[model samples]
Target chain A: MWPPGPRGQPRRVAPTIMNDTLLTVENLKTYFFTERGVFKSVDDVSFTVPRGKTVGIVGESGSGKSVTALSILRLVSAPGKIVGGRVMVSCRGVLQYAPTGTVDLLTLEESEMRRFRGGKIAMIFQEPMTSLNPVFTIGDQIEEAVALHQKELNEAQRWEQVLEVLRLVRIPDPERAARSYPHELSGGMRQRAMIAIALGCRPEILIADEPTTALDVTVQAQVLELLRELRERLGMSLILITHDLGVVAEQADEVIVMYAGKIVEQGTVRQIFSHPRHPYTRALLEALPTFHTTGRLRTIPGSVPSLAALPRGCSFQERCDRVQQRCREEDPELMVMGEGQVARCFFPEL
Target chain B: MGVYLFKRLLLIIPTFLGITLITFLIIQMAPGSPVSLKIQQMGGEGIRTETVSKAVIEQTKKLYGLDQPIHVQYLQWIKRLATFNFGDSYKDHRPVLTKIREALPVTLLLNFISIFLIYLISIPLGIFSALKSRTLLDQAVTVILFILYSLPSFWVAMILIIYLGGGEYLNLFPVAGISSQGVGELTRWGQFGNVLWHLVLPIIVLTYGGFAFLARLSRAQLLEVIRQDYIRTARAKGLSESAVILKHALRNSLIPLITLSGTLLPAMIGGSVVVEQIFSIPGMGKLGFEAVLSRDYPTVMAIAAIEALLTLVGILVSDLMYVWVDPRISFEGM
Candidate 1:
């Protein structure tokens, strides 16, 4: 829900005393129909993000975190289809369904999707170097994005808008940076340029899929801070998908833990950190190398199960220390563990 | 850049000399001699009073400086070639370089026109096929191009002559010769137009195969560029598909295509020998072929030297262009 207002300040409305759900995804299942048969990449993933907040999705590689983001954007490559799901976005006093309703993104014709993408929702890709076209100057790219969505603006106005967004992303020497090509910019500058392009339109939702994974630790911290400041200042919803727990701890208001193509845990930042019910989530927390830890650090035993041959019960049963016979016989569904917290497990640990 | 040009220029010396040496040795060692062939021709005409005696042939060779040792002849030829002198033709008693120079412009014109036509037709065709890959248009183009690429140039030339030459229903093009009768004695513009008209068939036949090859290569390279993550990024920025293709994908794809074009440049100058023969165009290939048949060592050696120089120039130009298109490339490494 992008409200037409001044650039940086959040608008005030009558306090409804109820959470405003900006996006609601239900039973989202995305599959890749390959020669080897269908591989379920995102199975029954469900999450809800209230307006003006951030949702952090955390998982190891191949854990369906990135696929869920791509599925939401309907950018999954060919042979991979969003098989079953309902992604609803409430924007400008209208409800839009993803795969089944009016303007279903999964089935929307490419021309129609073009109008919504980068206009209503935008994405910041993982590798900034490969994401920006090397031939175009950063300014030209940002200006093009602005003009594509806002065709009514004149060239001078569009350029002004580009400069405004570039400054908003806190890029120094915005004027100079605009004229420089991608190869001329440092890694951090390129990443910031990507963010400027993503936020140029002031879309309803910004999906950042591991935006800082390719940056060094110092740059990662700076990028995370910029994202937090931008999110708060713009009052725009953010879906931050990453496997780094440090990133989540620093910025996420809410968290979703996915394992083997399924969301095994979801909760507020405090709920997830204070008492993680899922064994996988607990193991993930323990695996984090803290300053106190000495000798060999703890690691989750065994690798992630292949999507084609997931365990029958809990997907994490094979790696769970507290696994029982029942945990292996039946798959668990998300059960309430605390206020606004859900974990899928046979026996929730306290 | 000056250093690069200097290096390229330095390379031409050995290349020209090497070509001259190879062509001379090959022609000399071949089973026939120009004196013997001329005597045979006179004998066929009933004008021969005596066979070509070995002593006369040896005397003729001495007069022409061919009696010198191979190394001495090679050194003398190089010295003359350094001053743009190819000595004299033994058969016609004309300057060998002058004859080659007179024929070269005609060959260059035909080859240039053909290459230009090929690029004009092939680039768009290649982009269209790549954009609509696996569709009916792509399939049709692929099949047609495959046929064209596999077809012999000479056969295609003969077919064009039969269909488009005078006396046929089409009668749209000249049958043979660089100019129409009496036009050779006219103004330069008139003579140029006349030569161009006669050149049409040979140029078309020579162009078809290379057009098919370049088109396929361009389409494949464009497809690869289109698959890059940067293209997706451009699309995600809400740029139109046309802008995505033209501004982003095509520019990057041209780097490879430019390299391929450089490789194709010499082919245009070399002129397809078989095609030239079939169409009866007075190009370098036709001259080279005649020199081979008549055992004209000087003419053959001059044409080979020119060809080697043109090829080296083409390659050098292509390498320089690569740096322009992609700044990341360094010619020093090459």
Candidate 2:
């Protein structure tokens, strides 16, 4: 907005997000400093959540999906550091505490960050069974969330909000469910209660980090269904992080495919599923079981490279079918392939 | 909950009887009885005339109800216990109940105050050390507490008496007993302060070991609790670090501490024995010790019976507290 770069010089300027963007994460790098070695958990990952749209980030375990969400909230524990990047959250129409502009969350003080967490952007974890405090009633916990962010509400009104959230999540008998402890509810009901808690503050952006992973298969479907409906009804932007490609295909408008802590492909869900540019993305899609597949299911030839000792050049070079001498010498930058699609490969499938 | 408590209370009866019976039999089987000891004392004084000693021993046995069958004696003892009457102490012909009454308040006072101080200091230290876990300060606290725990209570009491109780070093507190002589002349508040002043050293000796053990226990418990997924969720829910720790984590950690409170009853009587003996405080620990040494059946049995009963009640109270602290534990089934 201020200085123009030298003519024809490639400057690393912040990406432009249109008016509908709710959040923008740019060049986010989260590294874990361990005794053995530094683990580049989320290395130079960037994406955006368009307002009221679901963006699914899919990857295997240790692909930094959860760390990305945690980093967005500045909740990464010690030994892990958000080494570089900007998490610019649009505070417009979010909450009163944040100024009405795009604020870089990484620069905010921890006390100021609290207002953003559970107030503007809330998160729900995978383990619903353990995520809720065992000693507290589901209602009391929800009320705590509401009370912390909604300080304008009195105690009675806060409690009413608790019941309201419980009912919103479709828990039977809101009053009784509020009084019931986490153990008293079934796994599905507990997940629902967790969703209710996350929704208590009416957050503009909801991060569901494998929210259905620990649930039963049937309950998983139900919880996912509830999440889809809740997103539409509340018109909240959701950053759904999961390993399930099918879930992303069914629920997401955009998809970001991560490999070895880096995003290898980013596109519309249909584009990424039908025409994946990166080899890792294609391999993951092939691994998914379909009705027409016969005999043994297809799998990628090798496991993800250990983050502590990632090979030079390309992380996927050892596993890529089209590996070459050039691929061994240089890691490819994320290059635009087709309309609204990008891939981190020198040789795109297209 | 009420039905569960009533059933637990009812179960205490048989348990009390079993404990008392074992203690009574064990004490009775020991080498000497009150009659034999009386005879031995007389003989030791060079007053042993055979016919006179024999007549006196027989009279003593019959008067003390020792001539009855053992089972008959136990039945009589149990019968008296039912009416809240503990027969006379054999060592001194005073009523056992009266002896207990005289000793009970001092022991209870010392123990309750120490217990209160132990929890008050330990709980906060535990929370602090756990919050600052793995830091230099936490490690220092751990090392100091381990040292405190390793030092024997009696040894600590002796050291305190020497250094701070008018021994070789500076005299700061009363060395023996719970009160100054002629303490009644002081005003009421002054009397209380005087007693407290006398108690300072003994209480320090009594309190150090307890707070050491409990602080480590609570620190370990809280360290475990803070790592739980719910604590992470609490932090994610925009709670301050203190709210996440004190509100979300402390209650769960307190479950183990509540479970520990069940053991305090026996510790109240047994733990005080050396402390009371060294300080020369007339508490139940000394009373129980002297009763055992002299084979005073009535006094020993009374103390055993009370200890057993209180232990059962302590366990019950802890179980109820467990339920109160954690909603998951319900005693409805048993």
Candidate 3:
């Protein structure tokens, strides 16, 4: 067990579903040391994902959604470091620290972390154009991933696995596509290839960071469905990071809504979507253009607060329509609302 | 691709002709004349009055083919140039083509060996510096390479000669010429060994400058490529840092480096003139230098033509390599 201190103090609550918990991130803070100063991109935040369930971290750009995912993999490189947090991941009944898991991804002797990265956890990036190597054929790249993770597999088996995953991601003519370079394929195909690569190793957790954002809307729908199908078939947990609330509705069982590097609302998908508590969540819901409404979608009046020079009280106070005098003086802690729902706000809508 | 190559090949004609024409005019316009130099050398200190007469000048002009019209001579040179016949050297009385052919192999061999060594040493060093960028190793390499690059080739060559050429210390390598003795008597391996040994000083001087430039360029290119998204993807896919660097970043980085390497060919050839002079190696550079000093118009023009051709060939090879390295580049479009 890690030493208990102000920095590593555990939130006094019963650990939830230990057996099913695949990844647990507690009060994670990631800071970037820039020329100006240290910018806390991912301030204190926490979330958990059960095995075989998809958890969506929804936020607009710069909301630290992607940073949270990156921090989990310990992929946040220089200028950025996880100053404080415990990322506990349960692997085969053993609870290991996730960020610096039992292998200490942050401090993991490079060799050990190298083993954990592609083998235990893998990530799919946002832009497929920039994500895949243009010079190498898709087949060679996927085979390399397989070979890196499953070193015991013979060359023939590795090729077979690559073809199989390529098929799993529903890439048409897997063999032909495998030989093609990144530019030869359309954007959707490239994204599918990326997913195929991430799924190649059957990782315990797959971090899909806006994997479908670059594709066309129809293609985005299909990619999302493909992800759902893969997750279901493989029985793997997924952390889907996106700004699209619609994607969360379709793909996620639970949702964590982040605003300005802090989680504003955390609950089951139905609870957060139907009866959102935080004022920022309500603003987000209002901002979503709906077929049921004919008028212009309501816009949040002001921008999210800057992390460096945040206001004394709520970070979203300047933009909140329901802000009170007390709200300007004191920041509210995350408090439990109804069953399985938590909102960080002093006042919650019934 | 074929069409691109055809167009490039066609462009070479005007380019070569332009170079040949300019070289001819430049040689003619220069203050010294090969004819006068020849006459002066042949006449000697106590020349007879009859030998120094206008009749002797006319005879010298006729003997050297300078009596022909300038345009007609240019045409003749072009006609021979098309067939790779570079006329005769005024200084040695040997055919210019034969002289160039004899000297070219030595220059080519030296440049080739120096380039090979540069790559062998620089690439790993470049990659290492890039990987450990901002570290002491990177700082040390950057400083050393910068110093080496700034140093003059002749100065470096002189230092090598002084230290290795038995300057009160040790005689580790041969001081001059490409071969130890006559070329025919040396066995095949012995000949190769002799050439290599003779090349040590020149290669060191050339490699010091060349390796520094290439390493710095490669390191910069690699730093950019490493920051690219594909490299990040490779790492995310669980590839070891070494795998990400070698398989992903390095190849993409080499694309720009290939273009740089192509441009460096002419530079290497240019640098070899000083190198050849310092080592006393009988290469094209030395021949060209001698031709310039002695006012050998034909030899100078021929060397100029060869240099132009080499530059074109280097660019052509680089364009071709682009297709090989990146499939997306359509040569026909260019």
DockQ by candidate, in order:
0.54, 0.75, 0.72
Q: Better model by DockQ, 1 or 2?
A: 2
Would you list the clashing residue pairs of candidate 1? none
Among the candidates, what TM-score does chain A have in each? 0.90, 0.94, 0.91
- Cα lDDT, all candidates: 0.82, 0.88, 0.83
Error of 3 at A139 (Å): 0.5
lDDT per residue as tens, model 3, B1-334: 7887999999988887887798898888888887778667766766654557788788878877788988988988888877878878888789998898899988888888888888888888899999999999899999998898899988888887888888876789887998787866988988888888888888888888777878988899899999988888888876878878998999998887776567667667777998888889999889999999999878998999888888888888887888888866767676
| Cα misplacement distance, residue B44 of candidate 3 (Å) | 4.2
Question: Candidate 1 residues A1-350, lDDT tens each?
Answer: 22322434433322232357777787999998888777889999999878789999999999999889888877787778998987765544322322211233555557756766788778898999988887778998898888877777899999899999999989998999888888888888899999999887667788899989999989998998898899899888899999888789878999999999999999999989889999999989998889999998899999998888877888898899999999999999999998899999988878
What C-alpha lDDT does candidate 2 achieve relative to the native structure?
A: 0.88
Tell me the tens digit of each residue's lDDT in model 3 across A9-43: 43221344356677788889999888877778899
What class would a CAPRI assessor give candidate 2's docking? medium
Give the per-residue lDDT digits (tens) of candidate 1, residues B158-179. Answer: 7888888856558999878778
DockQ of 1: 0.54
Q: Which residue ranges in model 2 land beyond 4 Å of their true spot?
A: A1-17, A96-99, B49-55
State what share of the real interface contacts each candidate retains. Answer: 0.45, 0.73, 0.73
iRMSD of all candidate structures: 1.6, 0.8, 1.0
Task: Give the residue spans of candidate 3 off by over 4 A.
Answer: A1-17, A93-109, B42-44, B48-51, B182-187, B332-334
